[model samples]
Target: MSFFPAVGVGVIGVLIGGVCLMSQRKSLFGALLSMEVFTLSVYIMIFSVVWFSGSLTSACLLFLSFGVCEAALGLSVLVSLVRSTGSDYVGSLVSGHF
Candidate 1:
């Protein structure tokens, strides 16, 4: 119910998700999923803060902008990579020669 605990938990979740992403970078989908999870955790923290502090308008706007940009950028990069390499596995691209 307290803001501190909510923010703390969100930070922990984001950290854990980051670790997961770094450890699983060989897989494209895994990294994307981890990033999505991290983004969601951050959104949760922001929303919680907004709720407690009564700043929902700015927080929600920021969240929407960030979420849309993140999704678009991630998907676009993934699609381009896949199209160039003809594979969805990131490991293959790293080991390949241009």
Candidate 2:
């Protein structure tokens, strides 16, 4: 496959990740979605490098596992936050009235 194209894709992925990072999410769900987008972008960049090198397939699998687990943990924490606080908005959390 074309290496440079993959590299370009990786760069685009990073830009997406940056955008996700800079955004101010409205709720825990929004935050989790943003985090996932960031994770996927990083994973895309890593996967591209691994795939192009034609080795370290095992590492790629591990990376995929890490991404899944990270998302799960984030969701669980979000659920807990919503259940205990009764609100999902970031503004609610910031006001210290939850």
Candidate 3:
């Protein structure tokens, strides 16, 4: 597909991900998944721009690397939360005990 269409799709993906994140705040896993969606959409947008311009492909790779690191960090936090709180609910973090 063309760059503009790809960018439009990415924008839609970002909006959907944002809405999901806002509406599905009950679980940490769900939040992380939504954030991943957002990240992926952003990557798509950036990659399209770079691909069309034929430059800065390394910038896309750097963004992808950051996204991976973010995912790993979120997963580690989720695991720790589960271990300490025994649940993945977002409410667990608001109880002033974590």
lDDT of residue 8 for candidate 2: 78
Model 1, 1-98: lDDT tens digits are 67899888889889988998889957677788888889888987888888889765776778868887988898888888888888778767755552
Best candidate, lDDT: 3
* Candidate 2 off by > 4 Å: 94-98
- Show the lowest summed lDDT stretch of 10 residues, model 2: 89-98
* lDDT against true structure, model 2: 0.76
| Candidate 3 positional error at 76, Å | 0.4
User: lDDT per prediction?
Assistant: 0.82, 0.76, 0.92
Which of 2 and 3 is the better model by TM-score? 3
Pick the winner on lDDT between candidates 2 and 3.
3
Give the per-residue lDDT digits (tens) of candidate 2, residues 1-98: 78778777767867776777678567778767777777777777787888778786787778779989999998888787788778777666745544
Rank the models by TM-score, top first: 3, 2, 1
Clashing pairs in 3: none
Ranking by lDDT: 3, 1, 2
